[model samples]
Target: MPLPEFNLYPDFNTVRLSHAYLNVSDLAASKAFYCDTLGLQITDESETHVYLRAMEERGHHCLVLQKSDAPGTVDAVGFKTYDEADLDRAEAWFQAQGRPTQWVIRPYQGRTLLTSDNLGIPLEFYHKMDRLPSIHQKYALYNGVKPLRIDHFNCFSPDVDASVAFYNSMGFRVTEYTEDEDSKRLWAAWMHRKGGVHDMAFTNGTGPRLHHVAFWVPTPLNIIDLLDLMATTGYVDNIERGPGRHGISNAFFLYVLDPDGHRIEIYCSDYQTVDPDLEPIKWDLTDPQRQTLWGAPAPKSWFEHGTRFTDAETRDSDIAASPIIAP
Candidate 1:
């Protein structure tokens, strides 16, 4: 099948990737890793839940860690609509597509619409999140990596082509994609609404698992600092992948497992993609440099292991190709 046409106009104006709702066994331990170590600030907290915001995010939170039986289960991935009217239209749009939709109450957010994509990945849409004062210049408050803001999410999908088409119909533009050399089918895709490289990405793998949530850092130097901190502070084993550049986005990255084993990437230095007519970059499945621009190949766990969504069933990708993996 051919690539889906990018929908420049849609029924609703969905804006950006906003937040993730995660389930963790220990709130305090997760708090130490996310706030004390990663530099996100506490927006709100209770015995059962905690909300976190990046230094540059004005919204009440970009992450929510809620107490659960264990770590590494995702509740939902969130995006913000352009306005309340858009949120209403988004609910209608999902309903019109035969996807279930519901209105739910969330703290500090207005009129949240809960639904799922074609892949059954849980998603939440809202507008009017409570705003907070910027703390970007509060240098003393900066911690481990000094993350500036939430950047994007990478999801493991059973069908990258279907995912690309589904999201494309929702007005996301494809920015980059990887295709299987033999089948010429999409193996992975990066789609954007807020116009960086991606607001979300889909990689060919098990169905509907979250690979990682990326945060924008000040520079590559911040990643170096995080490496040193994790090394001495008893989190050496948590350091999973690159302090290297990705061939796809040209992003400098470092992946670390939080206390709950959820992956988070501290990232920076990708170029802009704001122009409407920008062409999507493609990589072949067999390219040696497709996954990494430099440094060692990603470890096997990096591709195979990902956090499952609560109650979602897993499906293996129909089209598969071996990418370079560190043994």
Candidate 2:
């Protein structure tokens, strides 16, 4: 069968990737990593879930982590289209593909569609959402550097090429890639959707899993503030790597993990690629600089450990691919 094409039906006019949900084993540790280390504010919370947002965004939440007893995984990811028309079109397109999706009504968020992806990750699409009424008054004091909102997520899959193909068919662009000695394998690729590179990305790994959730800060200085905040909060040990630049997006970055070992990345000043004619870049796996232009190698856990998510068994056939291979 041909790959499923991403069709933003008439109603699903413009879909933008949004928040990521995580299942954490320890609520306090998870909360400290995000709030104290990463500087994301806890907008609201209940017994099961915690809603968080960047200081600059008024959205009800940008990252929602929940407390769970079982082994953790990505619970869901939120995507928003331009308007109601786009939402309708999105629903139509998914339905046409015979994918199982459901319409959901949320409190701060409006009409949303729940679906599964080829990688077995739970996904969501929305058109309208309700913002917190107090954000305007409360967040006004956020004079410190602030990021806009959550931008993209990167996942590890057994098959990098297949994962890239799946997302590309869904309208994601491969802005950058790294390939190995064997022509049959790809190591990593940065993808983009709705504008910025990487609504989500696929890295060759041992299993299907989430690598990190990235947020776009307004300026590089905000990144400094983030570092300072992390240091001041005594969350410095949570720093995975960076406060360094990357060769791919040219964006400066810093990565930190929440309580359950789920990674969250803070980033800013990535190159923009709204133009249609841009070419995708490929990197040699042998490149000495692939890991970092300057810095120690990523920890073994960084390459090996990542969170996974479950899908609705939306694919007609399963393809075997390795996300991360032993280096």
Candidate 3:
């Protein structure tokens, strides 16, 4: 079948990265890491899941930690669209792809779509979600400061080419790519949909898995503030990497591990690609410049920390059976 018209997928004017789902082995530990160290506030909780929001938003939650029998698994990434029309259009787009989706409307979330990506991660889309006004607006104690929302999620897939094809088929345009011509393998590529990336990303991996969930802060200083807080909260060891700039988006970044080992990145200053005709970037995997414009390869940990999705969800039969390389 011909690909559906992508512009018809709700034509979202802007998309705010909403939440990340973690299947945590220890609920309390995960809760403490987010609230105590990261400074997120609890918005809701039940026996099975805990929902949190940045101090700025009264949204029901920005991150959901679901109690899973297995730790270190990423359940899904959530994105917020503008309205019901966007949700309806997105659902139509998925339905045309012959993919299975579960639609849900909860007490906290309005109409939402829980669908599987080619990488096996469950992806959620919603509109008409509500959030409280920033606390900074209410008190001088927080004057002129508020936490920005989530930025994007990096996902893993055994076959990068297949993952790329799946996302492109659904209108996710590539913003950057890393390839190895001699090996004839596509290692990774950054794709964007709605606007900024908040969906599937394919990394060179054995199968579907999650790499990290990223949140955006308004300024670079917030990253430093977070680092200081990490030290103060006794989560100093959780600092996985720097206060550095990424070549891909030219955004400053810091990566840390949650209590459950799921990765969270704080970043700022990525450029916008809302132009009608933005081209994809091609970076050679072997090119040192791909990882850093002026540095060494991403440590092995950066490559290994991302999680993989199950075969049934990715909708790609080949990936479901592939064996992952162990670090």
TM-score to native of every candidate shown: 0.98, 0.82, 0.81
C-alpha local distance difference test of each model:
0.91, 0.70, 0.67
Reference-based TM-score, model 1: 0.98
Of candidate 3, the 10-residue stretch with the lowest lDDT total is 317-326
User: Clashes in model 1: which pairs?
Assistant: none
Off by over 4 Å in 2: 1-14, 95-98, 133-145, 219-225, 228-233, 310-327
User: Which RMSD does model 3 reach against the true structure?
Assistant: 4.8
Error of 3 at 103 (Å): 2.6
Clashes of 3: 12
Evaluated with TM-score, which candidate comes out highest?
Answer: 1
Candidate 1 Cα deviation (angstroms), residue 42: 0.6
- The regions of model 1 sitting more than 4 angstroms off are none
**Which is the better candidate, 2 or 3, if ranked by lDDT?**
2
Model 3 global lDDT (CA atoms, 0 to 1)? 0.67
Error of 1 at 77 (Å): 0.7
For residue 290, what is the lDDT in candidate 1? 78
Instruction: Specify the poorest-scoring 10-residue window by lDDT in model 1.
Output: 287-296
Question: What is the alpha-carbon lDDT for the whole of candidate 1?
Answer: 0.91
Q: Output candidate 1 Cα RMSD.
A: 1.0
